[model samples]
Target: MIALLIRDLRLALRAGGGFGLGLAFFLILAVLVPLGVGPEPATLALIAPGILWVGALLACLLSLDRIFALDFEDGSLDLLATAPVPLEAVVTIKALAHWLTTGLPLVLISPVLGLLLFLPADAYLWLILSLLLGTPALSVIGTFGAALTVGLKRGGLLMSLLVLPLYIPTLVFGAEVVSRGAQGLAVNTPLALLAGITAGAVALLPFASALVLRINLR
Candidate 1:
């Protein structure tokens, strides 16, 4: 299991298709915003948090297909299904590795792009915090969609159809905390809820993802 996790992480990083592509997409979204909304720093500041959150969410979605695609194509997924480790554990490790590779890096880079949006210094910490708390859910839920669509050659639309709606609550509370923090308001409520979503995803998504993976493998 440890080997599978490490190999997948290494492959994702080296392939320039998982975290790498998502990060590039994230950068593009951050850069395009000022162009779309105009160059006013104040206006950028006003939209920075939401822009960052939305961009990160979309970027996370971009790599969902790769989660199980390679494994399925190479027959590793079938081997994985036969492993002594429970399918839920296999799903959990994969999600954790995905988060480590994609979600974590996006959270790390947000503050820098956030500066382009004129995000205040105070909001940076909370924005990063909220992303750190919220993005695991995005990654885990995406894994479930990826698992479900593993055997389908053209399931990208269906993957988004299945997983994007699940992303709404995470996006809402994550943006709310950043907006509130920028306004010097207490962001505890939204931040706590974001944390709750992360916890809930971690606890529940593996079972869901495993079930989907099983169906695909069968």
Candidate 2:
């Protein structure tokens, strides 16, 4: 499982890998939104939470298809299915890899993006904390979507369609945490909900993803 995790990470970081693509898209969104919305600091601060959360969520989608597509294409997935490590663990590791490559960078860079958006000073910590708690779920859920569409050609669009609805709860709770934090309001409820979603997705979704992958592989 460790080997598989490392392998996936290496593949994602390699030249022409999609590792940088998601981050680039995220940066572009942060830069363009300020330009489009004009230079009003109050307005920018007001919308910053939603904008950053939405950007991170969409950026995650950019690499969802690649989670299993390359291995599936090269016939490595079949061998993995037959390996000693359980498919559930394999699915979990893949999701972790995706999170490491796609989600972690976004979380780390979000504060800088927040500055660009004129985000409230107090909200920066909440933004990072919310993203930290929410992005793993995004990766795990995206793994399930990828598993569902793994065998289909041109499946990326379909995967996005399937995953976007599932993303709403996390997005809403995550954005709410930051929004409330910015306002100096209580954030415990939304933060707890976001954490719960991530925990539940991490605990259960890998099994579901493995089951879907098995069905698709057959």
Candidate 3:
């Protein structure tokens, strides 16, 4: 599992391997939103949590198709499936790698983007915390979506369609945590809900992803 994890990380860091694409997309959203919404600090602050969470979610979605598409195309996924390691573990590892490359960076840099959105002082820590807790679910659910469509050409659109609905609960609770924090409201409930969603996705989605992947491989 460690070997597979390392291999996916290495591949993601290579040229055209999607290491920075999501981050770049995220940065672009951070920059463009102010222009579209006008430059009022008050308005920016009002919507910052929602904007940032949505941007992060969409950025994470941008690379879901690449999770297994490359390996499946090149026959590596088949080899992994036939190896001693369980396909469920392979799916879990890929989700972990994807989170490391895409979601972790987003979490680390969210504060910088938050500044652009004039995020409230109290919300900054919550924003980062919410993202850290929630982005793993994005990667895991995305892997399941990717597995379902890995064999189709132009599967990116289909993957997004399939996965966006699954993302709503996370998005709601995650953004709620930040929004409530920004308002200095009690955020324990939403924050706990966000954590629960992530835990459930991590524990259960890999099995579903692996099942879909096996079917696709056959």
Candidate 4:
């Protein structure tokens, strides 16, 4: 499992732009948002939490296809399926790698982006906390989406379509955590809910993803 995790993380790093692409996308969103939404700090502050969460979610989405596509194409996935490691474990490790590479970067950089949106000072920690807890769910759900579409040549659009609806709950609760914190409202409920979603995804989605991948491979 450790080897698989390292292998995927290394592949993601060495695979040209995959390593930085999501971070770049997040940065670009942060830059373009102010221009598109006008210079009103008040308006920016109002929407800042949602914008950051949405951008991070989309950035994570951008890399979902690559989660399994390279291995599927090169036949490594076939080999893994036959190896001793359980397919569910493989799926879980892949999701973990994706989160480490993509989601973690987005969480680390979001605080800086929040400033550009005039995010309230009090909300920074909440934004970071929300992202830390919520982004794992994105990766796991995205892996399921990827597994479902891995056999298709043109799966990127289809994967996005499949995953976006599933992402709504995470987005709502995650954005709410920060938005409520920014407004000085009680954020405990949303934060707890976001953690629950993440936990549920981590526990249940890997098996579903593995089942989908095995079916696709067969």
TM-score of each: 0.96, 0.99, 0.99, 0.99
Error of 4 at 211 (Å): 0.5
Candidate 1: 10-residue stretch with minimal lDDT: 12-21
lDDT for 99 (candidate 2): 95
Query: Global lDDT of each model?
Result: 0.89, 0.95, 0.95, 0.96
Which tens-of-lDDT digit does each residue in 144-213 have in candidate 1? 8898899997888899998889899999999999999999999999999989988998898888889878
Residue 25, candidate 3: C-alpha displacement in angstroms:
0.6
lDDT of 4 by residue, 72-126 (tens): 9999999999999999999999999999999999999999999889999999999
Candidate 1 scores a C-alpha RMSD against the true structure in Å of: 1.1
147 in model 4: Cα distance from truth in Å?
0.3
Candidate 3 residue lDDT tens string, 146-183: 99999999899989999999999999999999999999
Tell me each candidate's RMSD, in Å, in order: 1.1, 0.6, 0.6, 0.7
Give me the runs in candidate 4 sitting further than 4 Å from their true place: 15-17
TM-score of 3: 0.99
